[model samples]
Target: MADYTIRVYKNRDYNAVRMLFAEGMLEHIPATCAHVLKLPRAQFVLFISFITLLLISRSYLLSLVSLAIVFTLGRRLLTSEFHQYVESCQRDDLLDIEESYMASNNSCFWVAESNGRVVGMVGVVPRSSEVMLLRRLSVAKDKRHQGIANALCHKVIDFARQRSFKALTLETSMVQVASHKLYEKLGFQKTDVRVFPSLFGRFANFSVLTYEYKLRH
Candidate 1:
């Protein structure tokens, strides 16, 4: 509903885009923590830790305090992983948007500008000759639900269609339920699900979901 414009990424928008991405990714920490806490393994570990501490100290107060500390540390561990992911992204394709996206004929990145501010962004790269991988779709927290994300997604979809790609594919973490709903609404179908391929993810049973939108030639 808010007024905005979508355009190709430029060098000046680098800092804004990177900051938006880091913030967007970090915002999922609470959801990730909740998902991790629901796992049977996490509960079992917490229970065992509490019991062990209680047996060693023979005091309910001390045991409860220790349990709280363990819970806090667990949350910190997840937070650290999220930070590391953000850093890795900064070092990767995000380090230079122009080279990583606009430099290629089949790959590009776009950002949504509202009142001269970068409010949303999305990118696409060829996965094969026929498939395009949609990546880095993010909208500023305060500017969401204003059709920014929807527009960005459509931009990629339109680009893929124009480029004669067969399908658009993307992967999102399990905790991103809202993102899943958005992708499904835009006609993407769930194709696969897999563990996150990290020690924390394995221990917490964290997973990622892949979705694909096929285009008609």
Candidate 2:
């Protein structure tokens, strides 16, 4: 088991939280790309592209090369999509954690520290008067599956219940298989599923899942 303590976010933990979130999100690119490739639409597009190249160049070698290029472009598109999310996060809530999460009773952010180093973090923000959105849940790659994520989740759950919130909601990418399990294990129900609105998302048929955990009063 990893030795760590969970507490409210502090100013000193800013850089660590930002780094962890970015790394965590970017780490999913490969998995996401793989998921994309498995989609029938994606496969059909690749097939069409390969066939077009084969006819145009009349060379199997050139067609194979073109197929490889298509794969590379798809991966790059997903990479750009993830990067854009990270940048938007940094520009918004993450830009000033204190202001975004610490200024009000309805919102809060917390981090898990092991030996004074931030190893995990999670935050909750007001979605409405009775609901809170759980955001920024991330654990260091090396420190994952040691109960760090579970602990962070419980921290948010406890906070929400104490605040009289009716429910806690969160969203995760379809490629995050482990996250889907974690949320399910914690009693969150799949409330909705929607395709991500982006060039890569549309092309790959990528989607995001929304989960909600209702607090029992």
Candidate 3:
């Protein structure tokens, strides 16, 4: 396996995280669009209109102008109240699995870096005296299947074990089968189903699957 370093995220690493998210968003644009379709009607209309403008503009100057408008509108849409609501839902989901890792407590966050560039990350938050919740596990597309996630996960598991955590829990969506399989391969067992109210309210209905792993000394 290629050597990589795992460390906590730093203030300077914020940009790297943003870039990674942007790249992942672009990679999953089709799925992202499908998710966007679940937005409220008004939001959907605005989003579709922007896409229509991007597709229909012909002349170079007109296209550039339309692109600029689209970008401005896109930024507004991303930062709008509805968007914030959706983002909060996501954050809540993450917290539901693990909240202690968010700049507080004895929780831990690890980022996998190779040649000085971040390639993956995992977040763990203490849930109780003997359990921790793991969330936001991700690996860049180019780094997938290369053990980056495995290494990061192992590091967190080791940290938790050393701290005397007896169990680790996580939640993953059906859309993320690979992640589910990874968790299973890491010795996690299916625990139960989690229902996020915000997700159900937005997507009409969806399921969040939960998993757990018992640590052994």
lDDT of 1 by residue, 1-217 (tens): 5599999999999999999999999999998898888888889999999999999999999999999999999999999999999999999999988999998899999999999999999999999999999999999999988888999999999999999999999999998888999999999999999998999978877889999999987
Model 3 poorest ten-residue lDDT run: 93-102
Q: After superposition, how far is residue 190 of candidate 3 from its true place, in Å?
A: 1.2
Candidates' C-alpha lDDT: 0.94, 0.92, 0.69
- Order the candidate numbers by TM-score, best to worst: 1, 2, 3
lDDT of 1 at 123: 97
Lowest lDDT 10-mer window, candidate 2? 198-207
TM-score, predicted candidate 2 vs. hidden true structure = 0.95
Q: Write the per-residue lDDT of candidate 2 for residues 2-95, one digit (tens) a residue.
A: 5999998889999999999999999998888778778888899999999999999999999999899888987787788899999999999999
Cα lDDT over the full model 1: 0.94
TM for every model, in the order presented, reads 0.98, 0.95, 0.65
Per-residue lDDT over 47-73 for candidate 3, one digit per residue giving the tens place of the 0 to 100 score: 566567657874656666776676566
Off by over 4 Å in 3: 21-86, 89-105, 199-204
Model 2 RMSD in Å is 1.4
As a whole number from 0 to 100, the lDDT of residue 5 in candidate 1 is 96
